[model samples]
Target: MNTRSTSRFSRAALPLGIAAVMTLSACGGGSSSGESSGSDTDTSAFSINLDDCEDPASATEPITDTFDIGYSAPLSGPVAGAVELATAGYDARLAAANEAGGIDGVMIEVNYKDDAFAPDKAKANGTEFIQNDGVDALATFGTGALSAMVDDQNAACVPMLYPSSSTADFADIEAFPWTTTILPLATNEAKFLVNLIQERYPDGVSVGVAENPTASGKVQGDAFQEVAKEMDLPIDAVVSDGDPVAAATELKAEGVEVVYHGGVTGTCAAFDSARGRIGYEPELVLKPSNCVNAVEYIAAGNAADGIELGAFGKDPNASENEGDEGVAMYKEQMDAAGVPAEIQGNAVAVSGWTQADLVVNTLEQAAASEEGLTRLGVMMAARDQDYASPMLINGIKWYSTPELLTGIDGFRPIKWVAADEEFVPAGEIISIRP
Candidate 1:
């Protein structure tokens, strides 16, 4: 739909450019502290060499000839259905990269473990990856799992790439230089939703927030409130629990005009059921992707009628994007891998595939550099690189630098049309910053 626009109202609400660069300095001495010194010199291209980095690399250590990375994801939990699809996407891309001879003929290996969506298990898996596997980096998922092991990963100086989380804190380069999250932060997504709210409900509307009753859910819900406050959006209801129907009922009773779900598919579906049962229809928004899928739709039936997905990627089932090369490639790989046609179109799977592609590109860039490919070099490659996934909406190029840690800055709001069983772009892609 190519309707992407810079959010005007929220830009005034949040920090911009250099002023935005200082938000995480308290954590790990942001390497861009020097560039933010109000210099007249052109500092946009400044490279970060933070003095407080936890595990400084030796200048003389030659880059390793081969690389081994670890992947920690929940493969046997309630989320396993989506996690397996994501892993399938990852495996598909990794197979393609390896078949192409792998970054200057330096073979790449991956170690995988199922943490069962348990934080304690995830920590144990991270320990094994660090101590026994000696992986150069890791790809992880689950908010709880990542939260439990991020500090451990940082202490080991093992860069964790693209965990399936949108928590703004994960992008704090100063505190967690070894960590990089792939999803757009919830705060940023809030800006787009706010713009939509202002447009559709011009007179101003009260918003309600629903969370999953977990530590991470509370963190995300609080961040949404903070951003909503910044934008002067009134929040009339805040519900946190496992039963989304009850939460939705509470919001409905409050006469809220819009509901922002800061939870997963189950909760979102529950809200839909509650709305349908009570005949209360409000503008609903789910964030950072993976909130709903085919299974959820089938379960909720017409309950999912007008649900909106806030995401940074292309709608895999969008009819307009049928010929997209990346989507085509994804289908072909899934077919080759024997993935069910139904699950192959899953957005979570596509995101996993995209994440793997990004990692491969970073490794390729690092391997090509004269500095060669070491753990530090991999981190350097990931920092500030501008890359576009063919599968992303409008071909949006995701960017990150030492000073700016958020990998994505915007999202394309999509509405689920249950009749057609597809998600279509509802508006032009909206950016949080200019």
Candidate 2:
């Protein structure tokens, strides 16, 4: 979110300016209730029995060979640090898998390209990866970029595995069967935040939602509003994409106690700056999927202190997670990628590793299938999985099914302890699904 700070990913050469815009219409409406769980009978594309893979009778012979996995993200430009860290997770875990003799003796070779966080470039990279590179599956980041290519990826039938986008529509299995978003849905995140307010601020809370002018941003703000209304929280203030200082001033005047940011990383930092300038401090919460790059918030000096976030994974700065295997894998990968020691464990990096872990795990499942490995088989393997990775909270698992595409249903609420310089879990992991 902080423009000045550079994570390991920004070390690459500056790229030429290219831009593209995308919008998601299917994701605007928030879910009516938070009860989580998923349906259906589409098994035409997959040759192997989907049920058999759930608990295969005998391990199928996996093709012991090298495989290509495509990766696309903004490797340059303003948000490069977070985007790069996401892919760095991919690189780290893949390296670990390879060192461990790969998934079922098959090596994963990630073919990466810099999209500059531009939608057009992402589409180009995706096309090349699917058509020319001949990758079995693809991994990607960014909501706008992924939204732009849903039709194309679905047409190509190449599984788009574990993209970093948190847009709800990316997980629409019926609409785009070939892709799966690993992050929690934006609407679900809004509900969880509202639930947090109801549980923690039970003594009548006044809330404000900071939103960007874009359609996706509006959808996020609307979601929070819907949930806040359902939970009976007082909505006293609202602001759109404009001067952060003005927005902060108005919210403070209204005595707002909590601010739910429905914008991107820059918008979050801007609000932090404004709050610092106006001395109007409130509980600042950003969309968990995008807020993982807390390094951006921390870069705002002391103004970024005490920010709260919801996550399916541990914060890189959380000392309680020092002994975590996922944390260790993250560090090893960052060091392997030559990331500076200070920049290692932010949200982006943690997410990268988690997503890569999902991909490799599914690949292993697909390889063990009696029908052997194929793109559709790999995609089908991701359905109805209850995956427990190193980064998830101890008891929670990333669960999925044919009917529900959102992989994870719960998030741990964590607060940034500026004094201690680490994120401490504020509450237990809350499950929204059944």
Candidate 3:
């Protein structure tokens, strides 16, 4: 089983005052502006100090005379292992690009910061990246961190691509022009779960949601409720912050047939601990982030039996992905990085690669200018671009539509078959209605 450890990108003790001042200066007198025109026009008419990381001159010099991207994620905290896998994936993609001569003779320079999945640290890192590093865009992971920096991301006009968040709020392009999500929103996953439950237990099955009290948790819980209502399924209970054993026992007492979990590993541990005490393990439906790999759940042994999950991508261990192109590439990269095969289902890695692809594709579409890359130029180029590559998941096409800024929809339903130790696809890919 893979260990759950802290991330490497732990919070820094630096004061944020300097970063705040730099952020203001980067935004051109702190005024919001509309999207730029999609022409080859030189939008660099106005200039701001692009240096602050080291000496002012070092800042002006492009990290590699090409595009520079900054990434923030929990590389050290409780979810460190997960974040590390994601970083590895991004590194693998960059390695491949560098070997191939990079994007149009310009190498992608990735500056990484560890947030430990903390919101304040994420904000501080975002400020630092925007102000000091002067990155072309911000790429990150974790729902809590991304949610906290929504305002700052929008204000700066910096294109934030593929932060590993699947919340519906991040999908709103009108509100968050610069923000785009790589994973399908929790609402879409919830809807797919509801449909599966209806098909499996059609006699109005009893459903329950075990969620955290955070904004992301509430959104997932609400999505579950909405889907249940639409499908006319009876929701037995919605538990928050209670004892997992006690809650599961109570739900079992109420004859709850299905349980939907919207929390993280700790919550999974809690639920697993309570399984024996409750005397029954209801069908478990977990959110994507919580169900990326089987190690955690498999550690629970019989407790995780009959557990089902909705995923936006394929699990690396699944038989369906065996010998596939994307999975093969992923395995090669992991081997080169010396990452254990057991922990290969790191969704963050896939997300990181996707983000890198998006950046490269966008840069490919934009015209080279002495003024360099503009926000509008990159965005407009990304709007119509598509990648015809194989995804880790079989039978699931990974791309974005015009309705959503990020070219990704929801995922196919997958069942955790402990007997085979793989996540078997439940059915065909389901389209998410925006």
* TM accuracy, model 3: 0.77
TM-score of 2: 0.80
The reply for model 2, stretches above 4 Å from the true place, is 1-64, 213-219, 265-267, 283-289, 315-317, 329-339
What is the full ranking by lDDT, best candidate first? 1, 2, 3
Ranked by TM-score, the better of candidates 1 and 2 is 1
lDDT of 2 by residue, 1-434 (tens): 11111111111221222111111111111111111121222333223332222212211222345666777777787567667566666677777777878766667777677887777888998888766665666766667778776677776667788776667767667667677887677778888888877777778677888886544566677778877787778788889746778887888888888888776643456677777888988865545446646666666657778777786876655668778765665677668766666656666667777787777777766655433455545666676366666677666677776667656768887776666666677778888766
The residue-by-residue lDDT of candidate 1 on 315-362, one tens digit each, is: 566687789776777677667767777777887777877787777777
lDDT (CA) for every model shown?
A: 0.67, 0.65, 0.59
The clash count of every prediction, one per candidate, is: 6, 4, 11
lDDT of 3 at 423: 64
Ranking by TM-score: 1, 2, 3
lDDT of 3 by residue, 219-271 (tens): 67788888778878778888873577766677777776678877653335457
